[model samples]
Target: MKICVLNGSPKGNESVTMQYVRFLERANPGHTFTTENIGQRIAAIEAKEEEFKKVIAAIESADAILFATPVYFLLVPAQFKRFIELLFSHNAGSAFFGKYAASITTSIHFFDHTANEYLHAVAEDLGMRWTGSFMAKMDDLLIEMHQEELVRFGQDFLTTAQQHPAIRRTYLPITSTRPDYKSAGIPMPLDCGDKQVLILTDAAPGSNLEKMTMRLASSFGKAASLVPIDDAKMNGGCLGCCRCAFDNTCVYTDGFSEFWKETVLPADIIIFAGTVKDRYLSAEFKQVFDRSFFMGHIPAFAGKQVGFLIEGPVAQCATLQEILRAYPSLQGANLAGVVSDEDGIAMAVDELIDSLAARCLRLSKSGYVAPGGFPAVAGHKIFRDDIWAEMRAFFRADHAYYTKHGLYDFPQSDLRQRLSTTFLSLLLSIPSVRESAQKEMKKHMIEPFEKVFSESPVLKRQKKEG
Candidate 1:
């Protein structure tokens, strides 16, 4: 059986994810694997019609399609994303219909689920028999256990492909019609004194996206500046070179670093405006995100408020919505809200503007940041552990930042907690003591909170004053 491998890594053959593919090929001599470096040669593929047709031809001939990529910014790299866009633009979906499909990605276990979810949805949308996904850690091939797992995964994939098993659709077809939106005029202005608000977009001139962004800014009444993503002097998408990991400097001398630091980073509230292209934002919008990889895994927009102004059927695209929500949360920014033209453009714009203004003001005043949920919490821990263990020597800047911010909150470092656990364990070794402790565990947990409420109003007031 011939399998088409869409390698979605800017590093091409050098990608760590491809090593797993090679292992699978060697382990299964019966199957033939043909690899296309789609992400690395996206520009050539887009520019040359023949090059693009070669990819479609490969898919048409293959018995199965394996999407192998490294998770970048919670999804595939911008280069790979562009290739996906080309499939839609070129009307080549028919080539992939009925093919057995699955995705494989390598990441630091940072939002890998979201990336896999995206690929699964994409395959289903293309009318493929979506089997499943194999998400590997970057170094999974090095471990004996993981090696066995990879072999099993490959065998399972081959079996599923040969049998041609029917699979349920994971995503509903997007049938939402594009609404004709006309601005109902901006509402009364709010006085956001000394607050820097930016409307960043990749919308073309005279596009509905531009109108939505303008209306949102008008609602703010502060004459916020619009920063077109195309105006940024970005050279290309991240190469996964890890050069920035050492000194926090990218290989390219593009002025994007200065623009990000001097303009984007300083904004108190940022409104991202874009039209949903294919299943995600535009390639230009993706470039803005992909280029930000120079900042490494740190939260570059911490404490900032962000809102989305989308001119598309966003409600129908659950994966894109998840990406939107997860992006801000992972960066330690509050997701003010996502407003879409599908919700009756005028009404949605007005409500979104009002919500953005209110949330920004409240957050700015209180300086309160909601704790990150599972994605950010887990992502931070993964990066923290990776940096402290293997990456410390290369990622010196991350090490310094982590040390300064006390991000190395290793659980074993708490001597009091460790000692208390040891004492409790020793006591609980006896059946009688264990029974007594189990009975009182609930009450013991409530004791700390009870003490807080037990304080007198006078004492509480004095503590507040102090």
Candidate 2:
């Protein structure tokens, strides 16, 4: 059987993800494997019709399709994403119809599941029989146990593909009707003062997204500045070289870093407006995200407020919404809310604009941030562990920042808590003590809060005022 390997890594053959593919191919010498560097040659593929035709032809001829990519910014690289966009744009979905599909990704186990979920959705959307996914850590190939796991994955995928099993469709096709959004006169004036507001968009001219961006900017009065991603001069997508890890400097001297630092970083509030394509924002929007990796694992937009103005069927795409929510939260920013075009033209647009303005102002003034959810908590812990262990020397900047910000809040580091827990466990080993502790556990947990309220200066002051 002929297998088409869609290599979605900017590093192409040199990518660590591709190394797994190479291993699979070497292990399964009976099957023929044809590799395409879709991510690396995306520009040429887009420019040359024949180059794209060759890729489609490969897919059309293949019995199975393997998507091998490194998880970038919680998804595939921008270039690979652009290729997926091309598949829809060129009406080439038929090439992948009924083909057996599987995905393999290499990451440090940080949101790798999201990437796999995205690929599964994409493959199913393309009318492929989704086999399964194999997620490997960056160093998994080096371990004997992990190598055996990879071998097992390869055997399973091949056996599944050959058997031609029916796979259930997980994601239903999303039908979107573009709403005709028109400006509802001038927005009500708001005193934005010296606050820096950024309206970042990938909206093309005459699109509803563009109109929404314009309306959002207008709602901010004179404070908001529009920064269309298409206008930004980005040389290319992130190389995933880890060169930026050392000092937070990208290999490419593209003006993106300067623009990001100068225009985006200092913003008090940021409005991201984009049209959803495939399962996510446009590839150009993703390019902006991928390129921003130069900032490394640090929270660049900490304390800022962010809102999303989506011009598509956002409610239907739960994964996209989760990604949107996670992005802001991971950056330590407050997600004001997501406004979608599905809410109708006049009412939704006007209400969202007003709400965004009010929310941004309120959050900025109050400095109230929603506590981190699972993504933020899990992502931070993963980064903290990785940085402190293997990446500490290479990512000195992250280490320094983590040290300075007290991000290394490892539970084991608290000696007092450790000693207290040890003592409590020993005491609880006694049957009598265990019975007493079990009865009083709930009360013990509430004691600290009770003490706070009983001996509180703030409550006393409020009582005196009352």
Specify the highest-TM-score model's number. Answer: 2
Candidate 2 backbone collisions, by pair: none
Clashing residue pairs in candidate 1 (N, C-alpha, C atoms within 3 angstroms):
none
Error of 1 at 371 (Å): 1.6
Q: How many clashing residue pairs appear in each of the predictions shown?
A: 0, 0
Worst 10 residues of 2 by lDDT: 340-349
Candidate 2: tens digits of C-alpha lDDT, residues 279-344? 999999999999998898988889999899988998888788889999999999999988877877
Deviation in Å, model 1, residue 88 alpha carbon: 0.6
| Local lDDT at 91 for model 2 | 89
Instruction: Provide the lowest-lDDT 10-residue window in model 1.
Output: 344-353
What would the C-alpha RMSD of candidate 2 be, to one decimal place? 1.6
Residue 212 displacement (Å), model 1: 1.4
Model 1 accuracy (lDDT, Cα): 0.86
